[model samples]
Target: MIVRITSKFGAVDAVHKTPHTGVDIAITEGTTLRALGEGVVDRIYDGSANIGKGLSIKLDDGTQLIYGHMNEVKARIGEHVHAGEIIGLSGNTGNSTGPHLHLGMKATDGSWLDPTHLADKVANVNWINGPITQIWGLLREKVSEITIDGFTDYLADFIVAFPVIAVVSGGVYALVRILSKGGATWAAIGTMIYGLLIVK
Candidate 1:
């Protein structure tokens, strides 16, 4: 059973979506958006990316669920969003022809997934549950910052290969990055506790 489909599956005016890139949910403006699964908010934008003004949530299993072209964002990065929870309002914000909700999912490896594939699945690890490792690593890539992403990833691949230094340093760095992003004032600070430390 298709929860949603194009307005015109056969007609010329039908919502023609790209092949396997996204799930086109036919909803008019002001439709309530729900979470695809349990996970933390990854990012929220006001019509920034090609997907338009939407939000991204990563499940505990590393699968990423992205909702695009929205009228409102009800979730924020780092917040543990639950399945079926309302996260936003559907609309035509991005490169869309009309008001609708585009739902897409991807694995931790960044492989695209479909609504059917998301029916029963799980995230293997909590990328956000730890410190700000991923965030700090990402920021450090932009500037001359010290991060523990490599070390953490290495440990993830070979748990015993990494020593205590990696864990301690990675945690410290992530804490600093979280503070930089925003300390206690942040909603999802828990997701970025494994970032790197910055020196100025």
Candidate 2:
């Protein structure tokens, strides 16, 4: 979890007389924003009346994190961001009264969750800098790519083969009945028609 975090959840603002939606980390403008976890950048929206310039990241565990009131967005849409990577910069944007980073978290269904819990849950893992580690990481990424390709091929094969196998088996059963009834020629024609119907 982030021990360097500043604000607490549900912190009330005296001027606006309302509780905040997420925790605010007071920081100077252009302060580097780091990803609390590994996730893909889901959205990067321009500043608005409410959130200002903000970015949304969807984590591997399906949690959606929102970093609002940014001075700049460094992450791109659909880009995979690793934990501790600089995703953006902090600033007073949107409806904010001062410079701060507004951190919010949501469940898979978009239900609000306490941002503190997520920060507390994440262990700030230190990087092991070495050539071997770098090589291993690259190889792991390649393995993941290959795994997805294999699954796609398997699914495609099953889709193409299932109906044909079912039709052939049914035709064989029909042919057996026709042979027993002394109607081999008609049954062979019917089997061809059945095969055509299956193809269509």
Candidate 3:
């Protein structure tokens, strides 16, 4: 995995899905949407372009990405923008169902690659602390990410070690009490140490 996962700002209603030209990612509305790369705002459309209330930025990389159904636009037309710059906010404006960014990346030669494949590379810095390896197992249908198999082992180890530790210390204290004090004067110390050491 590379980095951030950016996609559809919301759900795609029936009308949008009828055409079925994009993918949907469930996210919160108004999450700070960022540019995947340095780009010039080719055009900022608010329910004007065929993309529906979205904006398109033509990056210097010779690739353009269309961000649709935005809640707010932060970039202006013909403005130079850097990668990871806040470009818009997620919203359900036009032909969108929920809150998520739907991106359409176009190459100079006109080829489309799956966004999910490169989602990590362009994602936010949170990827550094992402539990992707552990999370993927949850999405992939693993029944035992956190299993009780080890709990019993750990508890058993603790149980077995506790008595030995307590007994050794308690025996030393009791021996010291007997040798130092002698007679019935030290009898209470032996019983006290033994009682304190044995829990069950």
Best by TM-score: 2
Q: Quick one: ranking by TM-score, best first?
A: 2, 3, 1
Residue-pair clashes per candidate, as listed? 21, 2, 16
Please give each candidate's TM-score: 0.51, 0.54, 0.51
lDDT of 3 at 133: 33
Model 2 lowest lDDT segment of ten: 122-131
Candidate 3 per-residue C-alpha lDDT over 123-199 given as tens digits, one digit per residue, 9 for 90 to 100: 45223334443234223322332258745664565577666656665666666766675633344444443333222
TM-score of 1: 0.51
lDDT of model 2 at position 154: 48
lDDT of 1 by residue, 59-93 (tens): 89887888788989988789998777778777789
Candidate models: Cα lDDT each: 0.58, 0.66, 0.57
Model 2 TM-score? 0.54
